[model samples]
Target chain A: MTAPEVVSEDPEDTPAVLADEVEHVRKTRPRTNEDDMTLVGSVLGGLATTWLLYERVLPFSGALGFFVSWYLVFLAFYAGLTAVNRPRAVVVDRVMTSLVIAAPSVVGLALASTVVVTLSHGLPALLHVNFYTHDMSGVRPSDPYTTGGALAALVGTLIEVSIAVAIALPLGVITAIYMSEVGGRGARLVRTIIESMTALPSIVAGLFIYSVFIAHFHMPRCGFAAALALAVMGLPIMARASDVVLRVIPGGLREASYALGAGKFQTVWHVVLPTARPGLATALILGIARMVGETSPLLLTSGASSFLNWNPLHNPMNSLPLYIFNAVKSGVPRNEVRGYAAAVVLLLIVLALFLLARLVARGRNRG
Target chain B: MAGSSSLPTRTSLRVVDEVEDVPRRVVARQSTQDLAFTHGVRSVGFLTLVIVSSIGIFLGVQAKPTLQHYGWSFFTEYRWLPNLDTIGIAAAFVGTVEVAIVALAIAFPLSLLSALFVSDWAPAWMRPLLIRLIDLMAAVPGIVFGLWVLLFIQPQATHVAHWLSEYFGWIPLFKVHTDVHYPIWDQAPGFASYEGSAFIAGIAVSMMIFPMATSVMREVFSEAPAGEKEAALALGATRWAMVRTVVLPFGRSGIVGGTMLALGRALGETISVLLIISEAFKIKWNILESGTATISEVIASKYNEATPAQLSALLTAGFVLFLMTLAVNTVAASIVARSRSGAGTEL
Candidate 1:
């Protein structure tokens, strides 16, 4: 938006040439310093309407509904203000501009509210260390919510998710390398299938593992079964995300490695992959994030247990998400309170991972 | 080539003596390491292909019986009673479609606007932050979404549903009931009197889906040909006119593709709906009704408890849901791929 200085036309130039030269002017002009009554009025009016609807008039459904209804009112009010002084086209422009602002507010508010509400409800349970440290084995659901913690569930989630990551990471990243470095019909087919698998539902993934590994084979309802299901969900997502990261690698890096007499596989391994490491990490984070909070898959594959089960293969294990699901459904106030607290912890973890993933993904790009 | 070089004989010794300087053998430059490395990578790639196929095959095999036994009745019959030798997912089919419709109806315009907001209206310093926030929204887990809605939305939305039913009974969709009784297997199945409803579930789903739709639309809007947009604005067209004439048309395919992908996700979503829906069998007209089951919810609820035949039925339902999402994503992916390839050309 920096303004360029005006240059006078050459005095000796012909009119036709001079007129053609003027076409080099900037397409969009900077707004003058004049007062913008339209914006001022729109802001004032939009707020008035929003306050009336959200604060005084409507019994809004929590923050999301309030914001949505408030936004609708804001949009109407802004457009009406602009319509009076502005031409038809300007009105449209103003309205769209206001809407752009409104959209973000609504989305932002909903996200903020989700986190806030979770934390508020979860705070009371978090106040009790037992909620974090104790298992629910001896504590009844009807007992005071402070009686037990999600320690068993937390340990179980780590064990299972670790197993899933162990399985998915190598296979997923290598597959991505294959897709990006080895150009062939097989790679293309793999890419397409991976893309399709990205949409495979979490519940279906659980069902698949449940039927094959648990029911048919009569395998134990342990963390391993859950891990297998989670691995299934994680692999395609990681592979696809890694593939996208690998595709953006500069072609010259590959050629440069080739010129140094590195083989195709060596070029992929030492060069292409190293260049895409940060993005690959992001991909891994994204894949893991998607799987970590998955309740339905774990619900079916890993039978819930109140006692801590360290070994994923030995016995049934509980996960944080499943624990949350169980506690929520128990309909006891304390259990419900415990569920909300677990949810808050889960949210914090997911949010942190999401932020770290973005930072890692962006760090290299910033270069 | 290695062993034969050492055993070479001078059969043409006299002729070879004149051409003595000529080399006896040629060596290929390729190394053993290179061969081993690429082959390993290639195998890993193909393993991906195997894993994908097995899922499809296994699910299909599991679902085969119910599909074969019931034939087309699986899609037409309404009740989900498996104990009396009857299991049908017609209600789930309708409920999924119904909720998805409502979600899309609510989500599309809002998402479209948010996309534009991030792309156009956001201040320069705020754009990156806004985009990151949108992406963060996608990371919120489905279970969390359920928790949010179950606690915060359900209680409040019931009044709205009741009022809508009371005033707008003329409209079939808005028509709600205060009470309904349908006892099945000694359990009260019909539950219009309660808090759980498709409308609330749809809202939760829409929240989950909003980020994706907005980000997609944002990407589309961001790619609108800069030169064309400048031209439109230079012609005294307003910002809205410029966007309408240049951006909207250019991103038409992107919008459709994005919405379809969101719909695909919404249809297969499990935890949120499972936590919210009242889990009834009949296909209800009013989204405000308490008991309505989606295909995904059905699978999650019945996976452990179902009988052998019922398990197969659930698998068939899951298969049907899988096929639907697969079809939707494939179409959307292809459209998105095609549009991406041709994106630069439009400018």
Candidate 2:
């Protein structure tokens, strides 16, 4: 198709043939049509110019500098091309549209790069079955990559997270029930406190548990104490999320139960809770996700262990996050690779939990 | 047949009148089970409050000895030498703010643009997936980001730091006191000086908090009045103009609240900062420099090896961080609540 020479308010300057093509349509939608060639051409031109500037003209050599300058040059090119036929306002709008679209792409690129880099760095450690089967009990940081693993940390994380879930889930849901179903002055106060508690630094939870249990109470640093710290961090998150979920449960369902002569408790048990079950699962998953990767809390409450200790209450337990922290901080390249591998495991677990939550949420939406 | 219909109608009318005539003061009688359940829920709620509050109380109590020993000097002293019986959080506080500022500076614009794009520019079929992508970003553990920063980005970031210091050296915040001259495209010996700066730590943290801020802003942007948006479009406003005038104004409080929430998270961010920063116990304003200490990072790095006295000092630092985050979170929550009500948007 022939390009429009100049699109303007003056009738003759506009393309009459293109106008005729769109005339039969209502044309009520926002005018967003643009030349495909201009978009492609500007981007290519920008890349070429940036390469020339960086390699031939400018002294800049880093990838970051090149990409940053390329983006700026691309915007300039886009503006220059669009302004050829379009008004200044239209040119500005087009440039902004490109920018808005570019922002998400940049974010997505960063995320993708992080995943790729992490996998590349950690994949070697994960190749060994030993990585999943053994603990670093006697292995030194300078040992070969296959000599030790994070099996103890993996088991410890599962134990501690489950205990935290067991402690916090019921209380969080009930607190949500209180705020949503049993409205009173105290509920309001409790709600405000809970909201603020959600902001409590995860480290503070560790400090609290350390002081109260390990320091003052003379308790051993065990996975149970770490679990308690995780519970402290996870409780407010679960309560807040579950509160929102419960509040979204339809009131009509509650009234239906009440109209059937069911008491408040029975109605809540049979009606409200059932209706919000999927949402509650989401809250549960989210709470787990929030606490599962908490290193600071585990660092303080559960001292790092190099043994495969199954019992959470009896000994120092190592979770995945603490394992990563220790390994990375060990300043050994081999150990740091193992740490990255454990981080990959942690990321996968979180991803799986979130996917499950999403599945439940989707089912609820369809139902 | 007429008598039968009239009798039923009279019965219905009687029922309707009975319902309408019922006193407003009438209440449902609670069964014993209902009463017990309500009390159970209330008590559980109270238990949660107790559990959460005990954190604050425990910190306050554990920190008491250290606070008493240090007096106001705790706030004034910059060094943390517990071995010498000297400790303070003044520098840590400044470092926390510096890192948070750098994080928010990088995160805010990115989140705002991403939210706007997702809400306005994305095709309907792609919206949910985009949202999920953002949410997934949030689920990535901080340790992973820290690893990425320490291993991958730190080297590349050193170059950017050098460039910034070269161009913006007049701004003290970007200045580094190195003797190395700029345009050093190669990784010179002096480049190692830029490796563990607050700028690098902040960049890692910015990624960690970006998803949260984006989700909040997206929620508010979607709640912009459809009528107003359409009216602006109908009035020949360009798509960008419509967004600038309608969506931006409507989402203003969301931006502020989201920024503050992200700031709160950045301030308390532990693993990433701990991984990326080299510990220094001096007040430093230059984020491009390599030595600074944040409250959470200090606590994390020191807690394992600290003496009881040092532990108490660390707890005091934790207490301060807790208060800072709590205040930021409360204010952000209130702003978000107000905006939600004003927009009449349900979660």
Tens-place lDDT digits, model 2, residues A1-367: 5544555677873566566654363556544456677888889999999999998998678788899899899999999999998888888898899889988898898888888888888898999999999999999988987789999999999999999999998899899899888878888888888988888888878887887788878899999999999998999999999888877776666666666777778878888888888888977887788788888889889999999999999989999999999999898899988988998889889999999989988888888
Query: What tens-digit string does per-residue lDDT give for candidate 2 at B1-347?
Result: 00111112222223346356533343445678988988999999999888888777877887789888899999999998877888899999999999898999888889999999999999999999999999889888888888888888888888888888877978998888885474453455667668788899999999999999999999999999999999999999899999999999999989999988998899899889988998899999989988899999888878867878888888889999988999998899888887886321232
Model 1 chain A: worst 10 consecutive residues (lDDT sum): A29-38
Candidate 1 runs further than 4 Å off: A1-77, B1-29, B179-194, B342-347
Off by over 4 Å in 2: A1-34, B1-27, B182-189, B342-347
Docking class of 2: acceptable
- TM-score of each model, in listed order: 0.86, 0.91
- Among all candidates shown, the one with the greatest TM-score: 2
Relative to the true structure, candidate 2 reaches a TM of 0.91
Measured against the true two-chain complex, the DockQ scores of the candidates, in the order shown, are: 0.36, 0.41
